[model samples]
Target chain A: MVGVIFKHTLRHSWLQALYWGLGLGLMALLVVLVLPLMDYNKMAELIQNLPPFVRAAVGVGDDLEYAFSTEGMIAVGFFGKLALIFAVYPAVMGMRVIANEEDAGILDVVLTLPVRRWQVVLERFLAYLATLFIIAALVFLGLWAGAQLTGQALDLSKLAVSALNLLPTLTLVLVFTVFAGALFGRRTVALTAVTLFVVGSFALETVGGMAKGSAAEGLRSLSFFAYFDALGVMRSGLAAANVAVLVGAAAALLAAGLWAFQRRDVGV
Target chain B: MVQSDPIIQTENLTKVYTSRRSQTRALDRLNLSVQPGEIFGYLGPNGAGKTTTIRLLLDLIRPTAGRARIFGLDAQAHAVEIHRRVGFLPGELSLWRSLTGLQVIRHIANVRGMRDLRCAHQLAERLQLDLSKRVRDYSSGNRRKLGLVIAMMHEPELLILDEPTNGLDPLMQQEFNQMMREVRAEGRTVFLSSHVLGEVQAICDRVGILREGELRAVERVERLTHVDFRWVEMRFREDVPAAWRERLGDISGVSEVSIDGTTLRVRLQGDFDPLLRAVSGGYIRDLRVKEPTLEEIFLTFYDGDGKRAAQPERVKELA
Candidate 1:
């Protein structure tokens, strides 16, 4: 009973999961392979010439020393902007899990079974978590393989830490979309709302990085993207507190989804 | 017959849906019961609360007031336990299009904790459904057949079906009726809702007629059709006089008397004693009595100015 809905959801989503994992993994591999071709001294000089606001907005380090490092290149090039593409998988899946079924009138059949409504929502969420885990593992393995082929000094532990760090941030988008679906019970409404929220958060994070003083700090604290420190994880290992925040936020969103789903009438 | 406890009961069950603009009472203060080992037909027109009552019985939606029970257990509180023994086929059947019919059946069986799929295979065979084809390729009738198989596979104690024969062909409808008879033979209860008066008349032991969110009548099928008015035409050897027509019209349970040459046509209700006495005269050459169809009987509750509709005298009042 624990995995009844999980198995059904996985059966429907395994192909999409594979496509996303391969796409993200391939991007990571290409970024890692192209890292060594650039001249660090010349790149650092060029970066240093930019204004401080531009540097902060683009997530360039103050000294430009780590700009040419394998960890730094992968973090900024692969994990930062490109990782946003992975959010689409969870977002689409989260909306489909409940809202699509309800809109199609299939939830009436599913809920009439002996299983409780919470079990259906929770199991589908767990399936999405499993999917995110697989995608992260693929990215980590791709980076490891790229490092092996190029004979670079890429630390496998650092790559693993940085790749795995994407989970909590991606999960925040996933659970938020799920919550919207459970609360609204309409696919179009959930998709529109979640897309707007994710895009706004990304915009806020980018602008907040450029702002000065407490303004920048406050805006960064408000954005979910700020908790995902891929560069920091590569350089100084995993940030336990930041991971905890993302995990805590995701947990709360999932709980809220289950609560809303249980209390509301399905297939309305 | 020995009396037993009701398998399904609703106590003033009501559902009022409130949108931002308006409020609609889908089901209003309905009190009904279905005894064990009987096929109870819930007959109503479209939007007449037939589906609403079924949904409430399964706890698919919350009631605005009152409560529903199955086997003495509250439907909302013990939904899971009640569902374990109740098989439900929703009016609008929607399935996972990606899975084959067999796959869908297997998934439901597993979820219901039934390990063996022999019953499902048997049902599919009887329904003439191809289990290997994906549901997306299935026609509406095929999808309905698949829904029926999924609902009946576990041999539940109670079957709640909403328009079960909606998309089936005539031949398939006969088979469905036969299947229901078999379920009753096994002593399981069935609650079926449909707007087709003939279908309900064919198989139901008793019926509850609903109109505009209210229960209009609940009566045994025999009693319902028995009390309905019949069309009677009498032909005499000689021309009938106006006085005889007036005499027949004056009978307690007869109305709409018309006389033409040697023939007279009239509608008769209640006991035929007075009409029989009138027809016993020697001038009558032929007398024909036509029993009204179930549809005609049902229309007595509908298609009226509300006040002129004739009510069934034997129908039990809602509790």
Candidate 2:
């Protein structure tokens, strides 16, 4: 038989997946469309006029001329800042996978089935990952379509690599949210913890960029944002080490979540 | 014939909840055994640990001490295998609001690897539940019916039902009792927990009464019925003298005596020989006796002077 829990979880998430995918896609398309209207030289001059601290905090890199390139424009606008919107989808879904069901009294019925507790967590996590992947794919398609419509000669390989790289970053956040849910077993607490972590990491990364020292660099390394490397990936190719680190962290979080969930009482 | 092995067994099963400020024991060393092909009623008031025990048996929650076994297999170690042969209906039933009743049933059946849905459809028909309606639109009673259908559809070796008839109408309750009887006829075991005494009394062959986290008594239903008391009212043709009133009060196994003009009301327990003799001397115009409600009988077990309330001969107390 088709895994009943997996099938039901997918059915439960299809509409949500569609909404996030289309919404993120539209946002990416809109950001990319604005790129063709700007004058590269004038935009570079305007960015240079801004305060040094403001420029640093906003992640304006040394290669100002690259900002005019299709890859650069899409990276700075869509992947750097706009991808935060897509992060919310996976975070909320990860928390809902178990904690929300337990709160709503649905998990009591589910756990009584012949399936093991770990199976419940693993299946739901898989379903959530699939949805996140769909959203990311749609965003990539949107970037490609926008480049074609704007008549920009964007590097298709760079665009694909950059888009796929976002998954590991988002996956790390998603698994952390799942870990919080399993540990707390309360939606509000888990949600609050995840939101604080995401926001705090972004703030730390931004401040670390503006600061000048090894201390700041050390703090930045702690944030998942530092390793995202959307711009770097676009300029060069994919970095195997960054992907490995992200995938490894996500795997660790997933294992911890499963262990915690199995040992604790559910629907309490 | 019933199977010799116990279908469900708990050896000193216990559960404790510990917080920073306090610790509460929800179940205290409860040892219970239910035979195959028998309907075992777990009777208790709210918060009497009925749901706790049921959850432990299903392996939904870990026991703080001791363990539970089903079909001679450890509940925690062999949960999947045990669950395969058992169907459970939680006391507070909840479902996916988005799916129709039929879809919910089909999803559970699929999980159990059941290919035939004929039994599910038949159960829905008998319970008068509209499987096409979304679960969000279902009334509380309809939700209960849906739960029953899901639990009974597969005809498992054991059924663990917690407050199965809650929110059900009297007609539906009757149907549920009949369905339970049919389950028993198939040689299946049912572990039913409920606070409603009459329902348990009507259907259960034997019952375990719980109070304050302890199993107070386990006895045959018929034996319990005999221990219940009755209310008696008598009408005299004229105002009786104080001596006659004293005579009625002196009767054995009688209490709560009161007089209103020519009518006297009193509670009668056990034998009636002394009461009949006491009233034979008076010019009795009429007499009426009323059976005590189940609640009254329940209170008799927990009321003041607990030692006097518990009838040693009928109630078998666990150590």
Candidate 3:
């Protein structure tokens, strides 16, 4: 039954997933195409002289020195700065899982079937997780395609690792939306809450990076974006500890969502 | 063991919808039972908790204070197992509008782990539904037909339909009635909720009337249709007499009497022979005796004081 629902969800949503994947991939490719046309040494100087808040918003941290490199420019400008926009796809997918269906009264039909409530939620989540992986793979391909097009001697492994890092953070956002959906059982409420969380996390991370002192740092630690070190992973390598935290949080949210959904009235 | 038990039963089944401001007791403590091989019509007006009771039985919503059982199993605890044997059509049917009707059928069929599409295709053909069209393009009637097809294709042992004939034309309704009769013939049970009294009278063996979250009466259809009340219309040669209206009202078993032009209408209950004997010698042009509609019969159960004069033995407890 779980597999049936999983396949059904995939069949209905494959087009939406394709659009998100292609759009993000194209953006990455376009950024790579324009990277080499400018002088990085001057660009890096300008980025450093800019207001700290503005620089942080564009994902330029103390690693402005690496901002001169092709990998750094693409990582900061495309991946890090626009991470919230990429997170929107997962947010929408998560809400659509249960909350949107319940609001539409479609949950009434599905629940009357021989399948359990938890299976529907779990299977749909797994389907979305699979689509997220596909989107990440497409993004890596886009970065690789740009490297080939620009004739830059970039390490493909590093680009692959950078793209894969988006998964943990994106999964966290997706499951958080699912959690809110199960808890609230209203599409508008769940979507509003998830959007606030995503947008707020981005703003806090950017402001915390610019402000001085422990209080500011404490606020940054509270933001999910604080754990997603996109630039560091692109420039260096994968961090196991950060990935574990994100995955652990995502698993917890999903479990809580299943528990709430199983216990609550549907289509109320 | 299952054959001896009621196909559907509720013991003090209750549902209360609550919010920040107020709480509505949607379904009061309802105790009802429907045996196998009978079509049990759950009759009620809108907002009368018919849908609420059905939702409770399906376990779509939890009850505030009681439980429902199906096939001798707890509805909430063994819902999945019960669902395997039950077919349901919601009062307000909503499907995945983006998918073609065929796709929706295939999806639900797959979910039920059924490989065959023969039953689904047959039902669609019988219902005159085009499965190739996307549901968004389907008219309201077509959507209802699709819902019916989906609910019956699995051929479950129990069919729970809410407003099953809404939006269907007369021809389609007749066909649906025939389908229901066939299901009954196969010795399966159907628990359908409807405000359409004629459909209930035509197909149901028994009915339970619900009013404002309370089960008012449960009786066999034959008994209800044969309830003593009836309407008698007579055309007299030159108005009979103005004083006869008062005289007829004075007789036993005669309720309301009125004369409009040359036609005299009388509401009668029990033996009509007394009224017939009184009017036999009159210069009458014509006479018509009409059976009371289920609606009228139901009105008798909800009198001005909200009390039914002739309560069935089983429903006396509710009274």
RMSD per model, one decimal = 5.6, 3.7, 3.5
Write down the C-alpha DockQ for each prediction. Answer: 0.58, 0.63, 0.70
Runs off by more than 4 Å, candidate 1: A61-63, A214-216, B223-296, B302-311
lDDT of 3 by residue, A82-175 (tens): 8988899999899889888889888889999999999999999988988998899889888989989999878889889989999999999999
lDDT of 2 by residue, B1-319 (tens): 3448888988899999888999889998989988889898998889989999998998878999989999999999999899889988888888999899999998888888898999999999999999999999999999999998888888899999999999999998999999999889899999999988778877888888787677767777776666547998988998755666677777777888888888888899878778888877679899999877755766675554333365545444332
**Candidates 2 and 3: which is better by DockQ?**
3
Instruction: Give the candidate order by descending DockQ.
Output: 3, 2, 1
Ranking by TM-score: 3, 2, 1
Interface RMSD of 3: 0.7
Minimal lDDT window, size 10, model 2 chain A: A59-68
Q: What are the candidates' interface root-mean-square deviations? A: 1.0, 1.2, 0.7
TM-scores of chain B alone in all candidate structures, in the order given = 0.79, 0.85, 0.86
Give TM-score values for chain A, per-prediction.
Answer: 0.95, 0.95, 0.96
User: Model 3 clash pairs?
Assistant: none
Residue B185 miss distance in model 2 (angstroms): 1.3
- Residue pairs with clashing backbones, model 2: none
Number of backbone clashes in candidate 1? 0
B113-166 per-residue lDDT for model 1 (tens digits):
889999999999999999999999999999999999989999999999999999
